[model samples]
Target: MPAVTRERALEAAVELLGAEGVRALSHARVDERAGLPAGSTSNWFRTRRALLSGIVDWIAERERADLEPGAMPTISGIDELIEGMCVMADLQTGPFAARTRARYALFLELADDPELGEPLRRQRREFERWTERIVIALGIADPVPATRALMALGDGLLLHRLTVDPELDMRPAIARAVRALAS
Candidate 1:
């Protein structure tokens, strides 16, 4: 049998997490999903924690990739920054919604686990840093609080859609938050 690539394993893990939640993410399960032998996933990720960490890394990479470059450039206004964030939120909800939802669920599951909590804390810090950078570039005098508020709002929107109504759109609400902040 051919060796399974790490990317293939991660993709399968993400799919499993999305389909059946994090409890279903085992080496055997990932191997089955990736069409590899039962131990193939273990060869790359020795433990379930390692696999979960990989999934977190994958989520971070996807989030970074979703960011708009042009919007990050230094600007003297908040409107463009908010618009860029809205665009990023839209992009996240489009092709990446499933993975995003999976990550959110996993985050909640791992929130109480000491082994995983530290990494998640670090990831949240990085996310806040990115938001801070964007807000600063947009010339906001107080970026930290605003960025945190925006992030909380974004998370709320994502969760509301995932749990309540798949058809619900949060872009307008996000836009309104932006407008309110800028006012």
Candidate 2:
């Protein structure tokens, strides 16, 4: 087998955290879960803190990909933006649920560690910048605040769906809020 890459190790760590929570994380465990040889994760991440920090950076990288030009769904108007956001919510709470859960778990897990938490802050700011552009295009008077509110609403809806109501359809509520914001 090929030598395990850092991404492979970080992906395994995220999967483990999502499936089993933060308590189950360890270099050896990540190696075992990744099907890599012993010490593979340790070779990439010398310590648990290093692993956690790597995980945060890796997750942020993945999330940031969605904001790349042309990576986002076509949104020529507020309605399309709302639909795109609902699709995003669906993805976060559906097919990509594991990663989403792992993200939130890590958010809470490393909330106090400013060193490790910086990646999360950077990711949020990047997302806000992307969203602010969309809000500006949609003609919001205060795009910055509007973008923040939109992001907060989406996060809240995602948390609700992930933690409390897996069956909840968030599109309608998202539509209403998006319209309100656009108005």
Candidate 3:
């Protein structure tokens, strides 16, 4: 049998975690989910910790790709930023919902492990920097804190939409928050 690629294993792991929760994630489960040989996933990721680490790395890569130039609308002001963010909110709960769910599941599962959680933290920090640049361009007096606040609000809204109310309209809330932060 051909050796299973790391990407294939991580993709299956994300699907399993997103659909069935963290408890359903295992080397054997990933192998079965990926339709590979019995030990394919284990061959690539010998331990659960290693497997999870690889998953986070893969998630970060995918998100970064999504944010690459031309992938997102150019942000020039508060209004444009809000529009872009609302679009992101839609993507988070729509097309990429499974990836969002998997990310949250991993966040909760690895909260106490700084080592395992560092990749997630790093990803968030990178996002913060990107948002900070936008907020600064919007002429916010204190862009750093405002950027943090906006990101936290967005995360909260996405979580609520995902876990509590699927019908939630996040645009108005995001718009208000962006306006307040920018002002």
Candidate 4:
């Protein structure tokens, strides 16, 4: 069995957030969802801020793993780069779906509280850096502009899937968008 830890509790919280939205979150709820003994989650996350931070940490950890040195696909050109984008889309619709929903819910929460925004701000910077590298590898003259564009596009596609089109095929669409970036 997986060892019980703070991270484990956070993962359960992510699932709870996805399944029941932000209102369902609580130390007791997390412990119940995580299958730990009563009071376990509260022991790890003593306050709402601590729990939100843990959720943010969980999102950040998954994102980091997705873009880690060895996990990333090699980008020889626009095609490969688009493939990577498709991969990102695949993640949102696949195993990461719940986490993605939980992240959006957290995004909304962050807007109402600056104190809870640090992890999100840092995560955005890291994602931007990753996008910048992809833009540079694509031989784009201005990485910042292209990176912003691609990030927006990906976000839009993801948002659409999460809210409007559950069956949307993001690969071909992302390929087209990335190809435009190369042109």
Candidate topping TM-score: 3
Off by over 4 Å in 3: 1-4
Quick one: ranking by TM-score, best first?
Answer: 3, 2, 4, 1
Per-residue lDDT over 1-183 for candidate 1, one digit per residue giving the tens place of the 0 to 100 score: 333378888888888887788777789999899887678788888988888988877776765554446534443566666566666566556677768777877788888886665555666787788778777766655778888888999888777766787777676787788767666
RMSD of each: 3.0, 1.7, 1.7, 1.9
- Better-scoring candidate (TM-score), 1 or 4: 4
lDDT value for model 1: 0.74
Q: Can you list the residue pairs that collide in candidate 1?
A: none
Ranking by lDDT: 3, 2, 4, 1
Displacement of the residue 119 alpha carbon in candidate 3, Å: 1.4
Please report the TM-score between candidate 4 and the true structure.
Answer: 0.91
C-alpha lDDT of residue 20 in model 1: 86
lDDT of 4 by residue, 124-148 (tens): 8898997798788768877888789
Q: Using lDDT, give the best candidate's number.
A: 3
* Model 2 per-residue lDDT tens digits across residues 42-69: 9888999999988898888888887787
